[model samples]
Each structure stands twice: as C-alpha cells, then as structure tokens.
Target: MADELKLLSTWFSPFGSRVKLALHLKGLSYEYVEEEDLMNKSQLLLESNPVHKKVPVLFHRGKALCESMVIVDYIEEAFADAGPPLLPSDPYERAVARFWVAFIETKLVEPWFKMLDGTRARAEMADGVKQMLAAVATLEGALAQCAKGRPFFGGDGVGYVDVALGGLLVWVRASEVLLGGVKFIDAARTPLLAAWADRLAALDAAKAALPDFGRVIKHAMMRRGAAAAALAQSN
Candidate 1:
C-alpha cells in the first residue's frame, strides 16, 4: 500500500524545513499544509501536536508525529528502501550522527535564536553569541573528524546531522546581515563549519527545502527593528 503522508509546516520555520529536507532526501511525496498563523494554529495542527502545538507535524496513515527531528527519523525508517540512507548503516556511526543532531537541535539553536531576537542586554547578548559560536566550533571539530575529505557531515551525502543544521544556515546568514554585517561563521573562526554551510546551502535538497534568502532577511530585519524598539522601551 502507498504511504499516505501529510506534513504540517510553516515556511519560515527552520524546524519545519528540517522535516522537508529529510523528506526530499528520502524522495518521499507528502502533502504540505502551511500553518499561516502559528498563534492561531489550525485544528489539525493542534490535534496532531497537542502537547507542543508546533509546526512540522507529520501524519503518516493517520498517525501524527510531532517534533522536527523525530519526524525526520521516522521518515528515514519508513522510507528506508526508497532512497539514499539519511543515517549511517553502522550502529556506532548512526549513534554518533544522532548525538550531533541532538546537539545541534538543542544546544546551538536556542542561543542562535536569542541572538537573532536581541532579547538580551548588549553584554548578555554578546555572551550568548559567544556561546553559540563555541557550540558551532565544537561541531566544526566534529565535522573535521567525521567528514574526512567528504563535503558533508554524513561523509559523502547529506545525513541526519546535515538536515538538522542545514535548515538553520539560512537564518544564520540572515541574522548576520541583520546584525550589521557581523560574520558569525567565517574562515578565520569556524572555517570547517563556514565551508560546510556553503556546501549544505548548495545541495539540491537544501535549495528546494529552504525558503528564499531575501524573504528571510526581510523578515529578520522587521524582527530586529521590533526587538530594538522593545529594548528601548524597556530601558
């Protein structure tokens, strides 16, 4: 029987983009339902992910899966026979990939968003940015160990870790622009990660899954302005 798949997503969400990239990499066909307003979520989304009420909810044959990375893992297992493997075949290697994916999703993402939102004071924001960069540097070291001579963290092709981080690279670039040309990932500081970001952005799956860079920058600029206004009012 053919799989009946539906994805609840938002275009600007990096989490949603992770699921999209995973689906693309697995060559899976799924109906995409965009949640236009996250605040006023659809009944489908609320029912699908009642706990989190978040985007990137995947419905497979009427069973809904919440959380972006969890959905990606489910897609990999469900469509294991269809396309290139998103995870390594070896058990140890697969565990390593899973670890890094978790690390990226949990450790790096929050600080990056905080930095982008400008919610912290200047000193605290600087510290948060430093912590975020330190996390990226750690991942850069991991990439160096795992990538060998290959272009991606998964060695030759995009893998679980790549999907986890690649989706956010667009926002990182946009945030950099919004921060007055501050370069977060550069050759001088995080060369491996900087280069990996470029490679990931150029992938066909990434190109298809990622939203328009211009739109991302415009949205980020508006957020930056709003954040600045809020900060000023608070002072």
Candidate 2:
C-alpha cells in the first residue's frame, strides 16, 4: 500500500501541506509530486480536479480526491487501520472540528487574499485593512475558546481540528509580510494563537511538513510584486 499512494502538491501551499501531513501521520508512504507551474498545470492534476485545477490532489489505488481537507478526511477513512486516529468518532466532536476548519478557510484565509488585492487600489486597501483586523480579532476569540487549558484542539492530543488550523500557521505568517506589515498572529497580542503555533511547530509531523518560513515569505513578496505589476500594466 505504501508504494501505491501518490500526492500532487506545491511547496508553498498551506492547503497542500495539510494533506501531506495527514498522509504522513497515517504512516502511508506516497510518491510526492511537486507541481511548481500553476500557469501550466500538470495533466494529471487537471483531470483529477477539473473543477478546481489545484494542487494537493491525492491518488490512492488510482482513485483521486481533491481539496486538502477533503483529501485528508479521505485518507483518514481509507487508512483507519494505521497510525494515530485524526478524527474523533463522536459525532459532536467531528462537527466541531469541521466547524473550525470552515472558519479558518472562510474568515481567516479569505480576508488575507483581500488584503493582498488591497495593495494597488486605494479603496480595496482601506477595506482590506478593516476586514483583516476584524478577521484577526475573531480568530483570537475562537482561539481563546478552544484553549480551555489544553495544548491542542482535542484537549491533550493533536486531532483533526488542530491539524486543520495548525497547517495554515506557516503560510499565514509568511503572508503577513506580503500584506504590507499586517501582523495578525503576533505572539505579543494574540498570545493563545501564538502558543498554539509554538506547540504545533514542536510536533515532528508539523516540522516535517512545513517549508522554511523565510523562503515562504520571500516567495509571497515576489507573488505580491508580480500581482502589483500586472495590475499596473492593466491600468
């Protein structure tokens, strides 16, 4: 089974890394395929995820699953017999984990993209800053609720919720620099989120899945510059 799994991913994608970590945690040996060219996507990735045409597609026994969290959930279901169990059996617990994942994807990541687009347009920049601050505050509140005296989302052990949130930390922080100095997850301000990040980073699987923060930040800055140049050219 180890030789059969294949992962299609990009190095800097938080979404892609989440799927990678889940497969690793399940002790599944997969062929890692990095797709660096987004403009010229791989034929396999296109056919596998025609709707999204994105990275982090998982192929297990020739069946393809798209989307990071969905693929991770699929991996958990298929490889339930191996490694630490990521999702909770309890229905309520599973719901809660899914809720947080949704929150992060919608409220957290979406606003950052807005903040990125805000760079060239004065109106967008103003709105983006406002939205980003509000988004960060909401995350701080959610973190406070989840912290309930435990290190992870599952109280003691790392679970699906933790993995979902934890996977985005490296990319989020790297993106802050590109958003022109918006520090959303500051250790000094959002202490609980900061602590959670530290705890997650200490885990072996987290460290293995993460790319160097410095390189991610540099790549983000370059992406921002390219976007800005394109916008200018259009104007």
Pick the lDDT winner: 1
- Which residue ranges in model 1 land beyond 4 Å of their true spot? 1-3, 225-235
> Against the true structure, what is each candidate's TM-score?
0.90, 0.88
Show model 2 residue runs off by greater than 4 Å. Answer: 118-120, 225-235
Error of 2 at 183 (Å): 1.6
lDDT of 1 by residue, 46-68 (tens): 78777877777888998999888
Residue pairs that clash (backbone atoms under 3 angstroms), model 1: none
Worst 10 residues of 1 by lDDT: 226-235
Model 2: ten consecutive residues of lowest lDDT: 226-235
Task: Give the top-scoring candidate (TM-score).
Answer: 1
